[model samples]
Target: RALNVILVLQCERRRFLRVGLAVPLLGTVAELREMVAREGHIPPEQVMGGMGGTGKGRDPLRATEVPSAVPQVILAEVSPQGFLRSLGDSEELGAAGEGAPLYAFQPPPARRPGTANPSPLAGNRGLHSLDWLGGQGLPASPGAAQPEAQHPLPSAARSSDCLHRGASSRVLLLLCNTVSDGHRLTRFGPPLVLREERGISWEQLQQSILGQLRALLRAEARAQGMGVPLFRIRLAEGMEPCTYLSPQDPHPLCHPAIDRALQLSGSGGPPHVRLMAEWDLNTKERLFGSVQGEAVEDAESVGLQQQAHRQQPSCTLDECFQLYTKEEQVRGTAG
Candidate 1:
């Protein structure tokens, strides 16, 4: 036993993410997500898209890496206008800003129920009938916030004809007031399950979304007593884009700046994360914002994200980005 020197090294068991504060780590993505949701003061369910996204790579969930003693990754919450105001060109992302990109988080496909690797939401605590987004600032159309009322879901036994999965289980129904046919359509989703995995094919995430939409449609059909068989469902255009903020560091020099973003988005900070995004049409609003460069391209993989069908949406759409794109063209032409 020639043990020359015994070193007393302080080790941390739980990996923590350096967000607004130092959050403890959990096993699965679902658990990690809850922490993020709490920090951002968002509804657990409404914290979709990049709720648990690392956002540095192709898969958001996969980006949730093991936490280190020091917060290795920094989650910087940049406002919509600030998002456009990166370390680049003018207020508008012009030809000089052509290379400037905006990023979004998309979860990878999850594995089937019985697979070798566990699902992304392996520890998903499918809390029964819990409206996780109850207190969040979900607007009730025309400057009204949704009343603090718990609209309990019908139990499985009562919802015999309802295709709404997790209705009896732990799922989050996202209420989307999408812009469809030049009008807003109040559509509630395919409930999202807390614990699910993204398999190699990434179909797992798609299945969750598509399956929920079908269930909701089926319930609506039965409620109306409509006898027409359901075929397919597609998200309408002109909806806003939901983007997640991820850290981009070729090396670790930018870690401090990342931390700063987290601080700014945390308590008493800016509107880093939002639910219903409207376009940032005012060029002046983009002032004082920095350029993010390559980090902007992080959202490029969004197209590769898996979904139910080619026409179906993998994530919810708001109205912010649409407004900017549509109005920017008109403004450019007029000016």
Candidate 2:
């Protein structure tokens, strides 16, 4: 009978261990942020924004606009058992009888040769643990349903813990382009015009661009068998325009924003490639005219060489060899 009781208790402990192991789904907000920053090659400061609210507000018209700080990411700890129990009324644990065995089993009489025996009832020492277990098999308490009605249980739990922890469970980031007071109109366009420059809407533009970029990134990742999610893009509120027109000769025709964007993209790869494409689009005129000019020059040189070869009349062997030597010297000098 005692051996049977011990076996039953061990089985119960094993069941609880399994449940505990499976209870939590863990992830850190910091880890996610770091991953995004590294993959995007974005500076941490750009993503987090400035330290204080010193900059102009996201809204252009607000009188006392405060610079927005990065929003925090939230992590929720969900209790599956608690959630299930909240679905309906739950039964309570039975009351303990006076002088009754607090636990159901006793330790074995002998210890094994190389192993130590665990104290019986050690598992039941904590009153809370015992209470939890005692009520485990019973129906959930009536109060369980109250939480389900108030709000989304997961969100509520995350918020409550987030507040108590003094950290936001939800994450937000910001990216901005610096603009000077002087260049605002020339580089960025007229402030009034920009403010009124409505068409597809900023939100729609952001969504469209982000969607396309994410799709491309996903396809590439899939091809490479990578598991990481693609980086996400969000528009920072309040765009400030800056002009980059030549200081010597300001052309109303020159676009500063496109120039600044091109400068940021640097010399190689996708950003440079994209910049050239955008430059061509913005310029409308043949921006590759210089390249065409270089090609034309090369063609003229080739034509001159071919014409000279054809025009040359037959000559004596000594004269021919002397002419070849003279041509080689001229070529070396040109080269």
Candidate 3:
């Protein structure tokens, strides 16, 4: 069976590597960790070192006691709600669920009290500490206070530069409400502007979109007195022709299509972008019914509603926010 694993780095939790491996169902989690280490080109020692646990209930000074070998990389099952349930080393891969998503998190180093944490940029200190002007024969005085070093860039300017860099990394995603009428595809409502910054993995993006849909779906289902249906989000490149972002694609976030779209937006192209979303069959059916209701009514006369069925296509992203707020209010009042 093919196993999908998300490798989380200890230093940078936001950026992760998503990898697929072909392994036997009977294989153990220990074996799985080894495979992940090999696939990612990470050291096996780092994946499963002698040290383990959450650094609790262990004696540090006990020389006579032997430390049991524990996997340094934590293997856990991520729930739809974003909670993690760690898997045991001896646990069978099949028990975790066939083709289920798994996360391999590299644990940060344990820190004890009274010990200082080292800076991540310590290696770069050599560049700053070196005195290039020492050969100029400037005599150093003993027991004299040194002058305060001046920085090339002021602190405020540096901070602003960082801020601008972050802003530049933001991707404006126009989330178009997409659905099918059993024959033809139709997209209604104003596309929502989803601002995604850099350093987020494709899996993280999928989860975020799914979480938003869950809340909206629940609120709508409650408002309509119907069952909440299961759904999935299929990301697409543009509005027309539906160039799908395949789940099998290793780098969906950094795809060439997305790059082209971003480039177009950066230029003097259309201010608005429309990205299509593919829904499951059940969600499509539910949405089609809602669309029928919208066709028969005047959207402006209806005012703000808990179930805004995308009747007003000309509405802006602000109106979409209002719709979500209205739904939240309905859900709150109902509860």
Question: What would the TM-scores of all predictions be?
Answer: 0.19, 0.13, 0.30
What tens-digit string does per-residue lDDT give for candidate 2 at 1-335?
00000010112221100000011123323333233233223332223222335543343454453434221111111121100010000111221111121111111112234643332223321111112122111112333333223222111011111123212111111111112233331111100001001112222222222222222233332233111111121111112431222212211112233323423432111111011001121221211111110000122333444555557477899997887776434445555
**Candidate 1: stretches off by over 4 Å:** 1-179, 183-187, 190-204, 213-215, 219-335
Off by over 4 Å in 3: 1-168, 188-190, 211-215, 219-242, 266-273, 285-335
| Candidate 1 per-residue lDDT over residues 1-335, each given as its tens digit | 00011111112211112222222222322223333344323322222223224422345436444322211111221232222321211122122113332211211112223544432234432221212222111111233222122112221121122222222222111112122223332222211222221111112222333333332233322233211111111211112332211111111111222223323332211212112212121211221122121111112223332221235424335555564445434445555
Steric clash count of candidate 2: 14
Better of 1 and 3 by TM-score: 3
Give the alpha-carbon lDDT of every model.
Answer: 0.23, 0.21, 0.41
**Shift in Å, residue 123, candidate 3:** 23
Q: Write the per-residue lDDT of candidate 3 for residues 215-313, one digit (tens) a residue.
A: 234344423321111222333422354344433332344444565555543211112223555444466555344432111212231233322433544
Return the candidate ranking by lDDT, descending: 3, 1, 2
Q: Candidate 3 at residue 139, lDDT?
A: 20
Ranking by TM-score: 3, 1, 2
Output the number of the TM-score-best candidate.
Answer: 3
User: Which 10 successive residues of model 2 have the least lDDT summed?
Assistant: 189-198
Candidate 1 vs 2: which has more TM-score: 1
